[model samples]
Target: MKRVVAVFRQQKFEDVKRALLAIGCEGMTISEVKGRGRQLGVKESYRGSNYCIDLIPKTRLELIVNEDDLEDVIDTIIESARTGEIGDGKIFVSDVEEVIRIRTGERGSKAV
Candidate 1:
């Protein structure tokens, strides 16, 4: 098993979600996050004052998939999230030792 963590600009969440669903992804966890990427951030003006925003809004998606599905899931996220621009975000995959479904007391792959 593997855990895929994908972070992208917030506005791209819907696009990524749709792609995931199209690929038959069962479930995922979503989060609103803020961070700086290679783009660093941008500047804004208000009342004749200017300020730099270092941390920008982002969306994080976390899901666990069987080993066989790892590449497909990563590809889906990238294709959906990439905007051909900076601050597009990143994806990380980690080894998962186990998974358990508390309600049914099922463990391992079945739990997932």
Candidate 2:
């Protein structure tokens, strides 16, 4: 099993969610997060004053999937989240040792 963690532009959340669902992903955890990458957030001007936002708002989506579905899930997220611009965000994949359903006591891939 694997855990896919994607952090992307907030505006692209709907697109990413839809694409994931279309590909048969049944569940995921979504969060509103603040982070900075190499771009280091952004700058803005107001009333002749300039300011830097060191932490930019982003959307985070996390899901667990079988090894066979890892590539597809990553591709779907990228295709939906890409904006060809800086701050478009990133994806992280990690090994998942196990998954257990609290209610049904299901474990492993079946629980996922």
Candidate 3:
């Protein structure tokens, strides 16, 4: 099993979620997050003053998928989350040792 953590622009959350669902992804966890990447956010104006907004709002989507569907899931996220510009987001893939469904006690891929 593998865990995919995809962080994208807040505006792209809905599109990314829809793409994941379309790819037969059963479930995912989404969270509103604030952080900065390479650009370290941008400058903004509030009223008559200009300020540096260091932390930008983003959406984090986490999904555990079987190895067979890993590529498809990543591709779907990348395609849906892209804006053809910087700060579009990032996707991190890592090993998942275990997964257990709390209600049914299901484990491994079935739990996903």
Candidate 4:
């Protein structure tokens, strides 16, 4: 099993969700997050004030699936999230030793 974590600009959430669902992904967890990457956020001015916003707003999605689905999932995220600009965010994949569904007490692949 594997856990896929994708962090992207908040505006891309809908498109990303649609892409994942179209590929038969059953469920995922979404979160509103603040982070900074290579672009390092941005600067904005109000009135005579100047400030640096180093923690940018972003969306985070987490899904656990069978290892075989990893590549397809990753590809789907990239295709949906790319914007030809910075702040597009990133994806991280890690092995999941086990999963247990709360309602049915299902474990392993069944849980996923």
Candidate 5:
């Protein structure tokens, strides 16, 4: 099993979701998150004051799927999320040892 964590600009969430679904990902969890990357956030001016906003708002999408499906999922996310600009966010993949569905007690890939 694998856990895919994709983070991207808030505005690109819809595009990423659509791409994921087109690639056969039926389930996912999305969250609003704030983070900084190499460029280190952005600058904002409020009330005539300028300040460095080091923590930028982003959308985080997480999904768990069989190992065999990992590559397709990653490709979908990357293609959808790419904007050729900074703050496009990142995607991280990791191994998941096990998964269990709470309601049915399904384990392993069945739990997904």
Candidate 6:
């Protein structure tokens, strides 16, 4: 099993979600997050003043999938999230030792 964590521009959330669902990835956790990468947030103007928002708002999507589904899921996220611009965001994958469904007492891939 694997855990796929994707952080992307807030505006891209709907596209990503729809694409993932189309590809049969139905279970995921979504969060509203604030973070910055190499570009370090962005600059904006209000009235006559300019300011830097060091922490930019982003949407985070996390999913657990079987090993076989990893590549497809990653590809789907990338294709849907890419904007050819900075802050389009990033994806992180990690091994998942186990998954358990408390209500059904299911474990491993079955739990997923």
**In every candidate, how many clashes are there?**
0, 0, 0, 0, 0, 0
Clashing pairs in 6: none
Question: What TM-score against the true fold does each predicted structure earn?
Answer: 0.96, 0.97, 0.96, 0.95, 0.93, 0.97
TM-score of 4: 0.95
Candidate 2 has which clashing residue pairs, if any?
Answer: none
Worst 10 residues of 2 by lDDT: 34-43
Q: With candidate 3 superimposed using the best TM-score fit, by how many Å does residue 77's alpha carbon deviate from the native?
A: 0.3
Report the C-alpha lDDT of model 2 over 3-109, residue by residue, as the tens digit. 99999999999999999999999799999999999878689999999999999999999999999999999999999999999999999999999899999999998
What digit string (tens of lDDT, one per residue) describes model 4 on residues 35-69? Answer: 99998879999898999999999999999989889
lDDT of each: 0.93, 0.95, 0.93, 0.94, 0.91, 0.95
Residue range 1-112, candidate 5, lDDT tens digits: 9999998999999999888888889899999999898969688899999999898989999999898899899889889999999878898999999899999999999889
Model 1 bad stretches (over 4 Å): none
Candidate 2 Cα lDDT to native? 0.95
Q: What does the lDDT read for residue 19 in candidate 4?
A: 95
Task: Name model 6 segments beyond 4 Å from true.
Answer: none
Which runs of model 5 end up more than 4 angstroms from their true locations? none
Worst-scoring 10-residue span by lDDT in model 1 = 33-42
Off by over 4 Å in 2: none
Q: Once model 6 is optimally superposed onto the true structure by TM-score, how far is the C-alpha of residue 32 displaced, in angstroms?
A: 0.2
lDDT of 6 by residue, 4-70 (tens): 9999999999999999999999999999999999869688999999999999999999999999999
